[model samples]
Target: MSGLLALLDDVAAIAKVAAASVDDVAGMAAKAGTKAAGVVIDDAAVTPKYVHGFEGKRELPIIWKITKGSLFNKLVVLLPAAMLMNAFAPWLITPLLMLGGAYLSFEGAEKIFHRLFPHADHEVEEDMDVGDPVHLEEARVRGAIKTDFILSAEIMTITLAAIPEGAFWMEAVTLALVAVAITAAVYGSVALIVKMDDIGLFMAATARTGFGRSLGTGLVKGMPKLMVFLSTVGTAAMLWVGGSIIIHGLDVLGWPVLYDTIHRWAEAVAHGVSEGLAGLAAWATSALSYGIFGLAFGMILIPLVTRVIGPVWSVLTGGSKPAAH
Candidate 1:
């Protein structure tokens, strides 16, 4: 009887440890996910555009296909790469993260530049000219997946950086959990945003109540504006997160000028404000400083990318040159 009781106690202890591990994984995943929020928002914002011009029936399937591709990118490709980096080349993480930050800065700046000085989008024109719907869909899907791979790399790297140093299994499990959760959140949001107008139309046409019909009508009208708002927010986030990453990275690498300057400015602003709002003031000041620097840095990169890198890449890949922005 005592032997059986001892075994039972051992089993309960094991179960308790397992439960604790699960909680740890969940907690780490949530924290890591928040760290990658800027990329996540941009992913959700960018995806719906890929489904444009497709039939409503096709939109969900396209999103599903992209979602599956995104999962594969994170799990099969990026997660392994991230693990390898952690194991063998841990020092590369910060530099790679800074590279991703630069990309985000360039992207956000390009969007703003295009908005300020409009240019014809040759890529969209090419898509419009494609005769075969099936081919166009395939091309768009491939393009989106390619784009997702880069963003997924960024997300995975950010998550990996956010994870506290721990056991190999714990880190692996945390990354996998973060991968699944982020993919679901991003693509699920994309699916809903893409289909919202259809839902609105259905409700408008079929709802029995007057309020329902009005709400449906409002949704239909509001979706475009909502998309624009999301895009603007995503761009701002990209710049903010990217700039912050670069500044912090510079500090880590022994170039603390930008980082220290930003902090000093934030501190000054914080002290100038009431105690209740000081923290908010500091954060706002820091963010604005980072964003302004990011915008300036990105602007410098624009001509170099378009004029030099774009042409070289096109030549090397045997692809058409990118259109000037």
Candidate 2:
């Protein structure tokens, strides 16, 4: 009886520890996930376009394919690379983060240019025409996977940077959780966004009542506007986040003046508002500044990327490349 009681005590204690660890992981993952929300928003906003021309039936499948690729990017490729970086050259994280920030800026700026010019994507439209559905699907999947790798690198690095140092397995578990959680969040949103039109169409045509049909018609009509809103928000977020990262990176690298100046300006402007509103004002002010900086950087990069980097890449690849569709 005594031996059994002692064993029970040990088992209970083990269970308690296991439960605690699980709780800790959930807490950490949530916090880290919140930190990465800016990128997450942009990722969701941008991904649906890859399947833009596909048939209705193919949209979800493409998203699924991309989601799988995104998982592979995070779990198989980036997760291991991040762990190795943490183990070995942890110092490289900040620099790599800066590079990612630069990329975000470039993408954001490119989008802005596309909007301003209104024909910037003409080359892409011209290139993307496909005859074979299978081949087109494969190409889209490959393209999305490649894009996801870059975004996953950014997401993982952001998550890794958010985490405090802990046991190796703890870090791994937190990251894996983040990976799966983010993938579900992003692609799940994509699936809904893509299928919404269909749902709306179905309701418009088949709803039993007028109100239902009107609601469905409204949804069908509103989807385009919603996508526009999402894309706009996404671009702004990318620039803001990228700019913020660069500023923070600068602060980390012994140049705090720019960040401090921006903060002070934000606070000063925010002072005119109510206390709660003031904080929001300050944040928005700072975000705007960072976004402007990102926009400038992106503008500079556009020409360089198109004229210099593209040519160089083309040469290196011996002219073999994605159709840019």
TM-score of candidate 1 to 2 decimals? 0.96
| Residue pairs of candidate 1 with colliding backbone atoms | none
Give a tens-digit lDDT track for model 2, residues 104-217. Answer: 888899888977887645436643676588887887788778777888889999889888899999999999999999999999999999999999999999999999999999
Badly placed stretches (over 4 Å) of model 2 are 121-123, 320-325
Best by TM-score: 1
Residues 187-237 of candidate 1 have per-residue lDDT tens digits of: 999999998999999999999999999999999999999999999988888
lDDT of 2 at 270: 96
Top-scoring candidate (lDDT): 1
Clashes of 1: 0
lDDT value for model 1: 0.89
What are the models' TM-scores? Answer: 0.96, 0.93
lDDT of all predictions: 0.89, 0.86
**For model 1, where is the 10-residue window of minimal lDDT?**
316-325
- Regions of model 1 farther than 4 Å from truth: 128-130, 320-325
